[model samples]
Target: MYKIAVIGLGYVGLPLAHAFASKYEVVGFDIAEWRIEELRKGIDRTLELSEAQVNEAIANKMLFTNKLEEISTRQQLNPKKRISDNVYHSYQIFFEYKESYYPNSNKPNNQ
Candidate 1:
């Protein structure tokens, strides 16, 4: 079976990961070690997926990690195949901040 890697276990990513994990083996990767630990304990601070959902995914053998290298450990199982071949899908979310959104209302002179 192919694997899917969902990077970012935050609001958007966690729900997507849990949904796909229902049918495929998923590797949920995050840069935050605390986030990974929370996930392992079936706690989702984002409140996207319930604790039951988290536990269900773990019971299905879904792997959660904070280490970047851990995401590729599965691909090592099939060195004969391309890394892309082992990973059937990858999903990620990125947020960009705009200074305009938060105008400098607190500027020393303005304040």
Candidate 2:
């Protein structure tokens, strides 16, 4: 089973993460603590997903977090595979490719 990390959890990432959660172990990562809290409570402030949809994702065992450590642990659990390769993101997020956990990761180019 692939573990996917969707980095952003805004309009794009949240929906994608929820869709993926149906088939994969998904971690929805965002930098805002409040956003994380809201999602955990089954709230979608961005309105991209309904509260029902948000709660469904939660019920599916999707992990929503702002901590890099949580996603990092998923990488370790699937060490043989590149968890970063499964990462989905919106244009707002950028990755420093040099980051150890994302060695094989590609930083999205908005250009």
Candidate 3:
């Protein structure tokens, strides 16, 4: 099974993680501690996903973690990057994308 890790679990990352959780192992990562807690309780103010959908994702082995080390267990990540001031802030995290696993893919590696 494909292991997936989604960093920056905000509007985009959370939903994407939830979707992937239905098919693969998913781990959601975020810098904010409150975000993790809120998600654990199935709270999404973005109104993108219903409470049922959030809970189902959580039930499907979707772990929300703040510890960046947890991400190493996954093979892939969503291409969703954090946008700050209308520009993509890739500097939020440093990563190396490999072409072997996913050629021409925008998704980043779990490294």
- lDDT string for model 1 (1-111, tens) is 327989988899889889888999998988666789889999987789899999999998888987656666554666666565324333211111233464453232324
lDDT of 3 by residue, 27-53 (tens): 888866666887899887677788898
Which residue pairs in candidate 1 have backbone atoms (N, alpha carbon, C) closer than 3 angstroms, thus clashing?
A: none
Better candidate by lDDT, 2 or 3: 2
Top TM-score prediction, candidate number = 2
Rate residue 3 of model 3 by lDDT. Answer: 78
lDDT of 3 at 66: 79
- For TM-score, candidate 1 versus 2, the one ahead is 2
Better lDDT candidate (1, 3): 1
Q: How well is each residue in 1-111 modelled by candidate 2, as lDDT tens digits?
A: 327989998899999999999988899988767789889999887899999999999989999988776776454665777555445342125554344565444322321
lDDT values of the candidates?
Answer: 0.74, 0.78, 0.71
Model 3 bad stretches (over 4 Å): 73-111
Residue 27 of model 2, lDDT score: 92
C-alpha RMSD of each candidate structure in angstroms? 9.0, 8.9, 12.9
RMSD of 3: 12.9
Please, what is the TM-score per model? 0.64, 0.66, 0.62
